[model samples]
Target: MSFRWVAGRIALAMLLAAGAQSTQAADFVDSAQRRVMLPERIGRVMPAGPTAEVLVFALAPDKLIGWTRPLSAAQQRFLPAKAAHLPVIGRLSGPYPTAGLDALRRLRPDVIVDAGPISAERSGFADAIQRQSGIPYIFVDDSIERMPLILRSLGTVLGVGDRAEDLAIYAEHAIDALRGRLLIRPPNERPKVYYGRRPDGLETALPGSPANEEIDEGGVINVAAGLGRDGRIAITPAQLRAWDPNIIIAEDRPFYDSLLHDPIWRTLDAVRYKRVYLAPSLPFGWIDDPPGVNRLIGLYWLSTVFYPDMTQEDLRTQVKEFYDKFYGDKLTDAQVESLMRYAEAKAGETRRVGGEPLVGIGAALPTPVPGPGGVGTGPAPNTGLGGLGLGPPGRRVPTGGMVPLAPPTPLH
Candidate 1:
C-alpha cells in the first residue's frame, strides 16, 4: 500500500480503539436519581462537600484526591498522617466556597461525589461541573437516617464493599439500638434538650436541622422543636428560659463555660441545675457540625448520656472502637477521658452542689459564683443529670456556629 493509505488505516484503527475504551466505562445512579457514567476502575475521587469528604475518607482513604477543607493542627491529630498533608480543594455545598474548575481539572479526579441533601440546585450544580470538566459527578444521599445505605452505596461505587459493609453494619446496629431504647421511653421520661451552637449560647440549631439529628434520634426532646426553622437561629434569653430544657448540649468549651457563667444563661433551668455539657469536637464534631459520618459516634454518645441505664456498653470502649474503625486513630485512655471529661458523670456519681458539693442528686443551688465571662468559677452543681462528651481544652471554635448559614470563603 502507498504511505498515505497506510497512515489513513492507522488513524482509523486509533479512533476505533478510543471508542472501545470509552464504551468500557460503568454507569451509576446517584442519590439524586441521576445517571452518571464513570470509568470502570475509579482510582482518584474528590468529595464535593465536607460530609462527602468524611464519608469517602472512611470508605476509601486511598482513593481520596484531597480534602474539601484544610485540616487544622487539632484535626490533623485525629486523621492519618498522610491526610494531614492533603491539599485543600474546597467544597460544593452548605455555603462553603466551591473549588475553582481549573483547580479541580488539574487534580484530574476520576469522579466527584457530593454526598448530602439531594436538592435540585445541587443536582444542577453537579451536572454543570461534570459538563464543564468532562468528569462524572454523583450526589449521594447523606441523611442521618440513611447512613448505612449511604455507606453501602459508597462502598459499591468505590469498589470497597467489604469495608463499606462493615461500616454500614455498625451504623445500622447503632441506629437500631438507639431506636429500641428511645422508642420505649414515655415522652415525659425523655429529657428536653437544647443544642447550644455558639460560644455565647445564644445561637442554636432548631428542630429539623441535620446538625441535631443525633440528638433527635437519641430520643431527647429538642426544645427547639416546632420552631418553624432549620439551621442555627439566635434565641433571646427569654426564649431559652421559656423552653427550660432539661439538658443543654454545647459545641465547645466557651459555650459550655458561658452557660456556667453568663448571667442571662444562668437563669435558665439547664444552667441553674448545672445540666449544661460540652460536645466533643476535634478532628470533627461528634454531634453535628458538618452532619457527616463523624456523627456516628454522636449516636452512641447521646444514647449513653440520655439513658445511661439503657446503654449496656461502656462509653470509653465504644468511642475507642469508633475512632479506630472510622478515623483510623486508636485513642489512648487519656485521650478518651479528655473526650468524655464534660460528659455527664455516671448516675450516682458525686457532683458539686450549692458550693458544698453533693454525692448524688441534690437540691438546686441559689446561684453559682460568677467566673470570668459570667461563668461560675466553682465546680458546677450536680443535679444527677447526664451530659454528652467534653471537648479538649483550647479547641479553637471555627467561624460560623455549628452550621454555617453562609458558605465560607474558599481557602485555595
Candidate 2:
C-alpha cells in the first residue's frame, strides 16, 4: 500500500486542529530567537530560508503558512506546493527588503525557522529583527554531526520534542541500518565515480564536506579524491585524464552540452564506461544547500548507486521513512525511483550511454577534521580561520561549491 494513504489521514487530522489553534501557536513567530515548542499540531510555521522552507514542508506541510517563492527556475517547477503560498521575506539576515521586517511582522507567524548560521555571526540581525519586529527567531544548524542535537532543539522549541526525538533517534538508527546493509564490494568491482557541478566544471565538496563523507561511508571512493577535500577546484581536461574515473556525475544539468563537446571529456574513461550521471532536482537547490536533517537522504541515494546489486530497497526505504515519519508524506512509487534514475546518465548521452547520484562529506565533521581549532559542524559557528583550520569564521560555502580552509584573510 502507498505510504501516502496513511499520510493523508494524518494530514487531514492535523489540518483541522491547526485551523483552530493557529493563532496561539502563531505567537512563536513573534518570540524573536526565543525558544518555543509548538503543540503536536504544528500551526503556521514560517520558514525563512529556502532550504529550510523545503525541509519544513517535508516536516510539517500543513503547519507552514508559506515560504518565499523560489528565485531560480529550477525551484519554481519542482519545489514543494506550499512554497507558492508563503510570501517572500527577501533575504532573512542583512537588511530586509520588499515587505522586509514590516510584512513579516504583519504575518504574525508562529515560528521563524532558518537553517542559515545566525546565532554567532548573523545574531545581530537576528536580535535586531526579533527585538524590533516582535518575533521569536530560532536558528537551525545543518552540521551532520549536530543533526540529532539540532533535531532535539527543533523539537524543544517547536513543542514536538517527544515526537522529534523519537523520529531523530529513528533517523540515526535507520541511516546506520541502511549503511550497514550496503555491503562494500572490492574496489575493483566498484565503478570509478565523479561528482561534477555545472558551468562545465568539477567544483564539488572537499573531503571534509558531508557529501564526500557520505561517499566514503557508502564504501565508494570519490574519483576526485586527488583534488583533496578542500572542494571543487578548477581543473584542466588533462588533469581529468590523469584521474581516469569510470563515472562522471553532472551536478547540475545546465552544463551537460559543454561536457559532451569537450575534446578531453569525450574520450574519458567515464564516458567510455557510460557512467555519466545526472542528479534529480525538484525540491531544488543542491542536496547540500543549507544541508539539514534532509541530508540523510543523500546517503541513501549513494548506497543504492554504488551497490545496486547488494541493496534492493535499502535506499528506497530511506526516502520513504524520511518523508513518512518526518514529513508525513510519501513519494509515489514512480517519484521514488525518479530521484536516483537520472544519476546514471549524468553527462547525458552524446548518443548512447547510462547515468548515476550526492555524496555526503561533512555530514559528520565533529570538529574540523581538516584543521586545528577544529570546530565540528556544531551549532556553534566558528568564524576564525587560523584557530579552526577553516575559512574565515561565519564564511562557509560561498558562491563556489565548497569553500577551502585557505590561509586566513589578511588584516588591514
lDDT of each: 0.66, 0.49
State in Å the error of residue 203, model 1.
1.6
Q: Can you give the lDDT of residue 372 in candidate 2? A: 40
In order of appearance, the predictions have TM-scores of: 0.77, 0.63
Q: lDDT tens digits, residues 366-385, model 1?
A: 12334348664332322221
The segments of candidate 1 whose C-alpha lies over 4 angstroms from its true place after superposition are 1-24, 348-412
Candidate 2 Cα misplacement greater than 4 A, ranges: 1-43, 71-84, 94-99, 116-119, 162-166, 178-193, 210-233, 256-263, 312-321, 324-329, 344-412
lDDT of 2 by residue, 1-412 (tens): 4343343334323433433123245323211233333443446767766656655665556666665554465344344444444556554553343346776777777656666433455555666666776666655554443454445445545555457556656656645644565433432354555666655654655444544434445534455543344334555555566656665667676555556666657778766656566665545432464455666666556555555555546556666676566555556777667666665332222221122112232222222222346433322233332101112223233111112333222111
lDDT of 2 at 410: 18
Error of 1 at 277 (Å): 1.2
CA displacement after TM-score superposition, residue 46 of candidate 2 (Å): 2.9
In candidate 2, residue 153 scores what lDDT? 43
Per lDDT, the best of the predicted structures is 1
